[model samples]
Target: MFELKSVSKTFQLPNKDSLQVLQNLSLTVNKGEIFGLIGLSGAGKSTALRTFNLLEKPDSGHVYFQNKEIHGGQIDQLRLVRQKIGMIFQHFNLISNKTVEENVALPLKIAGWKPALIQARVLECLKLVHLENKNHSYPNQLSGGQKQRVAIARAIANHPDLLLADEPTSALDPITKIEILDCLTEINKKFGLTIIIATHEMNIVRRLCDRVAILDQGQIQEILPVARGEIHPQTKLGKMLLEIT
Candidate 1:
């Protein structure tokens, strides 16, 4: 449902130098699939994710969502298209002032839903993430896992077709990470949400994704299916991640 065609992005440095962050990075994510984008830092994994929603515009390529090219200056079209796409950050971007329910309900509010409908959707989303009891709590009162769950709830509040998760498990402990991954897996299966996650954690990919892409220096090096026995100690990215974990 998402496609990036011949996408390239570059930035001009202060020293009159040019840095290419993404180079002809073409990728297609199918519906109801959890696709993993894996790479070390500075490999353009985050950049590629940003391009999906036009957070970062490609210099010379096209980004298509459900066959419609997304370009800047189309505010109404962007908003309509973006409602189908949701993004979660490494840091839980919950509003410090808003309660969990309110935070989750924010999108529905923006979408102009009535109060009763918003309340119902927020409750369902919180329950889906196993955070039903914490709806009245604030972000500061919750654990890291709870906070991330809140973020996930908010992201899916609109029933988005695609979810872009950037390093969703990077800030959590092992057990919490597992819980969060389980929540994502459940969401994918239950809602058939197309998910594209950018992460350095092979375990996350192994546990959740159906297909994986290895990126380096702004280019995709390899894209493979998630195999049981093939995720061995010899794979470079897998090995590094295992060592770190």
Candidate 2:
């Protein structure tokens, strides 16, 4: 569903030193698959993920979604492409002032959807995340888990074919993490959405992803399949990460 080809990215520090976040990084996410990008802090996993949404443009490579190159396009064209790809963040990224229904409906509204359709879709999305009852509530009124659920609902409200989640469970408790994962897994099965999760938590990958890629220093060290039976990690970092997971 998506591919990052020979991508490299760099950032300039305040002191004028250059930091290369990604160097010739390449990976693919298949249709209807839950793929994981696993890496520790500053390993460039998030930067790599951002390329999928064009939030971070590569210095020297191309990003392809469903075989279409995402490197250059008109603003309206790019906006349409982005509408087909949903993204959720670690911080939940919900509007503090908007009610749950309003938050979920904002994207559709921006797309010029009719009022009745937006309301219907918002309710459906809220129900998918099991938060329909909180439609009137604001972000401040909800618990952390509920807030993340709201974010998830808003992301999927447009019925996107692909979902990009950046450390969705990083800020939640272990038990709440399970709740969110269960919701994600259910959505993947119910909608057959191609899901890409960038996270440091191996357990999160093990629990939700069908295949996992271990990233280190801006490159994919290994990609491993997961199953119930015992399996070994091919790369050194993969093996080490497996041991800790």
Candidate 3:
């Protein structure tokens, strides 16, 4: 569904020194599968995930969605392509003032869907996340778990081909985290949505992903399949991630 080839990114520090975040990173994500990008903080997991939709433009690399490469010149094309990709964040980026229904309807409205269709689609998305009852409620009124579910509903409301989740469960309690994971699993199965989750937690990867990529210091340490049977991680970082989970 997506590919990043020799992608590299750097940030200039206040003192004028350069810090490289991703160095020649390359990876591919298959359709209809839950793929994970796992690493510690500052491992560039979020940056890598953002590159899929051009949210983080690489300094020197190619990002391909489906089969087409995204370039800076294709502004109009990029906007259209973004519609096929949905993203949710760790903090559950929601509008404080908007009701759940309106939040879910925002993308459809932007895409110029009629009011009736937006209303219907909003309801459908809310139902998918089991939040139909809270459509009229504001984000502040809901729990953390409910807020994340609403984010999920809003993200998938546009029927995006790919879903990018960045540190989705980091702010939740263990039970809430499990609930969110289960919700994600259900969404994946029901819609065949391709999901790419960036997280530091290996447990999330083990429970949800079909394959996992371990990233360290701006590069991919290794990629491994996650299964119930015993498996070995070849790299030091990969083994640590496996053992910690």
Reference-based lDDT, each prediction: 0.89, 0.89, 0.92
The residue-level lDDT of candidate 2 at 130 comes to 95
Q: Please provide, for model 2 over 148-186, each residue's C-alpha lDDT reduced to its tens digit, 9 standing for 90 to 100.
A: 999999889888879999999989999999999999999
List clashing residue pairs in candidate 1.
none
| Stretches > 4 Å off in candidate 3 | 229-231
Ten contiguous residues minimizing lDDT sum, candidate 3: 224-233
Question: What TM-score do all the candidates reach, one by one?
Answer: 0.93, 0.97, 0.97
Stretches of candidate 2 off by over 4 Å are: 229-231
lDDT of 1 by residue, 2-121 (tens): 999999999899999999999999999999999989888989999999899998888999999987898867999888888778889999888999999999999898877898789989
Per-residue lDDT tens digits of candidate 3, residues 107-214? 888777888789889999999899999999999999999999999999999999999999999999999999999999999999899999999988898889999888
Number of the candidate with higher TM-score, 1 or 3: 3
Candidate 3: residue pairs that collide: none
RMSD of 2: 1.2
Clashes of each: 0, 0, 0
Give candidate 1's root-mean-square deviation (CA, Å).
2.1
